[model samples]
Target: MQESHSNESQIQIRLVTKQSEYAVPDIPLSVPANIETAGLNELLNHLLKENKPDFLKQKQFDFLASGELVRVSLIEHLQERSVSVETTVEVEYIQVTPAPQPEDSILHEDWVAAIETANRWMLIGCYDHSVSIRTPHGKPVTSSKEHKNIVKDVAWVDQQQPSKGLVSVSHDLTGILWAWEEGTDKIEPRVKLRGHERGIDTVAVSPNSNRLATGGWDTNLKIWSASLDGDDNGEPASKKKKGPSDISTRTPIHTLNGHKECISSINWTNNHVLYSASMDHTIKFWDAELCGIKNEIVDQKAFLSSSWSALSNTLLASSADRHIRLYDPRSTEGSVCKVMFTSHTLWVSSVAWSKYSEHLFLSGSYDSTVKMWDTRSPKAPLYNLQGHEGQVLVVDWSNSKYLVSGGTDNYIHIFKNKQIFK
Candidate 1:
């Protein structure tokens, strides 16, 4: 009984491989208590040599306990599983498969012009001159009526309300604010912002949702109050008929003019600092408080899209040269990119930095591919996600788990990282 009790303390490990060609037998071994994954790996390698000598150098194997890829020591896993000698442990040995591909693809009508998400809702602007809001689970909530021309971009206004407000810019030379109430299909257009001399191209809401900025073909960036009454209610002082000139009475707080050509993109890092990119091959940083250009970055090539990282001091821009450039504002090199990633064969139209990773970003190009990049490896993309039949116009990383992309193919693809679930 004493010997049997001592033997019961040993852990029984079973090796299971997925490959049918290997013909590995179900080799079970009793290991002493507290054996870690490293020790188990060494034991498996030895067992493979004894069973099939030639298969030893074929491929490397990773051990997973109870469907989870093992990264911690075996003792930790055992403690997590609460395993004792009374139960046998099952560890799956899988050949390192490439990173999991996108789990699902969602189809949409009209070219996807822009996409933005917050919490449970995602806003999509379409080239069909309309916008639609949907849940991440792929359920349509509401769709807006057609604008005069193509919808260029969309932004979600951050507020302390149960239902959020939406702002969309269009090539019809106007920006529209819409009210979206949760648990309902009613989408009401609240205001029509008509201050841009030419067609508006992009719009951004400030971090606090108190200010809004729009850049346009007139080579200007205009800032406006996010709310009509300067309150969280988003209600106008008086109920007025909605028209192209409805909100024309309101004036811009600041009219920023520095770009030589059409403004391509705009981003507000905070309430006071705004970044604008242009076809003029320059990016200008504005101090909203002082109403002055804090810094201007000039490039030899045109910048199609630009995004500021909320997690770091890095700025990512996609250029017509089919390259994504990373910039450090604190660097002495002016606007010169600290690192450049080249993978796309055509013009890179949009770039977005991940909110969850400081060194990760996503770029979409005319080549119909959205490439995920890690700044540490500038030569190659971490993943080349292909689904769009035409140019991938925009790509956005949601809170942290999902990647949403829109393209000229009139499709929106939502990708999930399986590792994030584990």
Candidate 2:
């Protein structure tokens, strides 16, 4: 018996029949071991005759359905590796087939992450409930088994937690929070958190583990608070007893309001301040108190009152009305500072801050170009990113000098500095 080499989708079991007696050779467990079994006589033998023995019935066979693994043992074996190389493919999307499994799923099967066993380069993950973990940069280091629903969004909160937990946001306002225990192959669901009135569009984790915020079509932002030791304590949700105006006192400690339309995005600067964008063509800043929001806005006068030039900070409120206003978080006082704004012909759908550079920001829109600006230079775009076939929907940067943008064309574009878009 000899070890075989293959990609994520297949495992080749090469058995050598040089002599009548042979034994299966061991393979290095570090290479992400997977096993396929066949008879020694049938291994690597293709029969030309139509009627052959049952063992040699087929050659280069494929797995119809994966068999149950009886046991998993680690072993040390000889190593032969392919050359390490790099290239980029600019396409709408690449479809990767999955390994044969007892059950099938609808996710595209790219090995987005290196096998938990090793790390180097990867574009996808295991197709059998595969959860490919990718940072803003395309370094595929970790991935888990994809669970029940397709994940709409995911966030990592506790860095020191042994099993790094991920909250997989789903379209049904319900989700499974999973954690992978270190040195083990278990990614069990911690629990299911609830309280959204409708489908969840956005979720944000506070700097501290004290709170979690969710916003979406229900036109409400619910804040959950507790100090559970990463256990499943989801209080089963039912109809609200209080009237329509009665605030929910379940897990949601605070539920903020003031948006007439569905929420577009939410960002948590710290444990207290929550910044949110909405379809009302506005961005609002909230001071989340204990189960409540400090909804007081400064009804102050604009410095450039001639235009929509209100110098407000609480409302880093920029809009398609060709204006960005800084409204007062408090009452109209003397000009503390000028509110920042940007000029876009179409609506600004999203905004992202640079992880390395504090004040640098990027915004994408119905317009094809992604404009970069700094806090001091919001009046004009510092530079433009022009490559997406359609409107850009998301823009995020990592401290490791990589910028990632995803658009409607179903492609993720990675760019470095002003040029070198991959």
Candidate 3:
């Protein structure tokens, strides 16, 4: 099961079972900046790596806690050398801790879009001044129809985070950043990010939750430091960030200027590569650190305007032309190799990859259907899940097998094969 704690970044564990039947070449899962290094050494002994099964079984202990989240399956059985553990048990939280802060509201509404409470949820911005929140199971739990104007863009942050409380983006009343607590009646404007001479179109937080990146109609993608870099608790630092206002004040670490048209989507990759899919009918890759153009492909089949993202080392881009293109981030300069999958009848609205299985990904379209693709084959969809009536706007997968989807028709649907139980 996927789990995280507030007091700690990495989960400490004491393993006592003689390791067996679970080993594999390590995944590229490096420790993020949020992980805490403390207590690791203390817990290692509790894991108490031993080779004898009788000794371990007799002690009644066997578990592997990485302090790192594992999203994929292991190819090898975890055994002695292949296994390790943590045992120093000062105190740990296995679930979301009510972060230490103040009175907060987990959700709020200007009118009535909808509200959702789950790990992998979605919020849609309708052009008609409405918003919709859906559960990870693909059910609309909350929605609002009484906004002053239409909802432009939507994003989410850590709701369980006492400090990060109620993270969302909306065009409601002069472009505001909101923070509320769960089951509360207060939604306060935490920061007013107004640097975008225009409206904010999209925003994404890093997996580590220390940074915020936004792309907008102003034709620019800006990455900002959402919190201090010193600790995982996300405490405010005494050092001052350049600017007059606290929010929208920090200079965008990188300002991409190549897209001739509005950028439809942006995603971060494992190797620190940043990708932008633009209306200019091309997809470009940029070195995350160097901030220089690495490769650009023109005439990406139907990928004129699409929403796409990356997984591990692969990049997926969708296009209005009615096709999705997959590229290897490791492809060398002037030698980029790509495979295209033509399946959708209209613009590909959203794309997401399964964290547990990189080879599996999903795409939603204007045609009102969500299709799951097995990148292992790169040709067509393995499952054509159908339910939504209007244009499908957003789609995300919970760990690997469960799927969550949303559409413009004001409906949310969860799709999971019965075989998961089998």
Candidate 4:
């Protein structure tokens, strides 16, 4: 009799959802107080199964109690939030993102240090002192062994052009501009950017494709004017091999100085606004048109990488402290960090925001893993990707259908799944 009474203990709860197909009655439900996430999942499934007998496959759900994910027992969650169990508790439900399937793994001759993808092409930089343009299937399109040292970064200056323009920076302290048509097998070097005193670590192209931003170990950011109009004629630079005397050299039109240490990454939100991350533990928002620093976000740990998300209107930074953080650049109260993801065991080297979803983002870490995260669920990651044999150096989500990552393992890992979107 005592066991029966113990099992009879219950709490009053109300289930809700924005999805009309999974809607249940709006009335309060009396459920076991000790029911955990698994038990509630099973109960919800049973309720839906009875209403629609055709629902044969049990669907998984994430429950939210008091606007937060319910990771504990029903009563425990209420208690922690200081909610009274006697009153009807409102709980929300949403479907979880399916585990992304492994799509492909492309092998490289050297460590793949950087990656950028477009609708028709993919660009990669390697430690082998080469930059290559390849198809989505990993077929080599064109490559350049022009950089004297390891290629640290690469960017597509114009993605819409049939003849694409690109910029590459290297540890050799130089940045090169190249123009190549889609079907061509040769990467023609156009301009040599010479100014940085030390290794150039990162490069970013403006949205208009008329300017380039290069940051380096010298703790300086340099802007250069890029004009690929001269190469628009039918004559391809690939038709003839160009020597050192053939290419013209140019220096930065404007140099922005603020960071105290190596500038690790750069991103342009628009043609005039720029953001830069540095090893000195700061992210500076710049007015590129005026060549001035408008504001800065200070942190405790050195940042390794940074990205700007126009969808979320926030700035993301990967740090030496092994975490990915998001800060609102519009915040006037000292640009406080709004969210922090702390799943990676080692330093997070890179982070890329999804172009399609405001909530989805990717992170690569020295722990040799890449994790898919959603802003809604801060306590845990949506999925953990493990394909790299060594520290993951970069990740890219420029294409909506695929998430790409590369690392010291000398390979590019692709993850894809149709069910990733609601």
Number of the top candidate by TM-score? 4
lDDT of each: 0.77, 0.44, 0.50, 0.84
Per-residue lDDT tens digits for candidate 3, residues 83-117, read 42232322111211111121111222322222223
lDDT of 4 by residue, 216-285 (tens): 8999999887665333221243556667336657778889998899999999988999889999998998
Write down the TM-score of every candidate. Answer: 0.73, 0.52, 0.59, 0.87
TM-score of 1: 0.73
Cα lDDT of model 1 by residue, 1-422, tens digit: 22343422576777787666544677677876556556666777777787885764745556777555565665556566555545677777755423536745668878998998777778888888888888776788889764788999998887234275888999998888777777578777766777788888999988888789999899989988777442223446556555533333355778888888989999887778989999899989999888899988887799999999977877998888998888877688554578889999999999988776676678899999998776755767868887889999999875566688888777888877444421
For residues 33-126, could you state the per-residue lDDT of candidate 2 as single tens digits? Answer: 3333232113324322322344433333222111111112111111221211121111111111111111111122431111111121112222
Candidate 2 Cα misplacement greater than 4 A, ranges = 1-131, 135-152, 159-163, 181-188, 225-259, 280-289, 296-340, 398-400, 417-422
Top-lDDT candidate index: 4
How do all the candidates rank in terms of lDDT, highest first? 4, 1, 3, 2
Backbone clashes in model 4, listed as residue pairs: none
Q: All predictions: root-mean-square deviation over Cα?
A: 12.6, 22.6, 15.7, 4.5
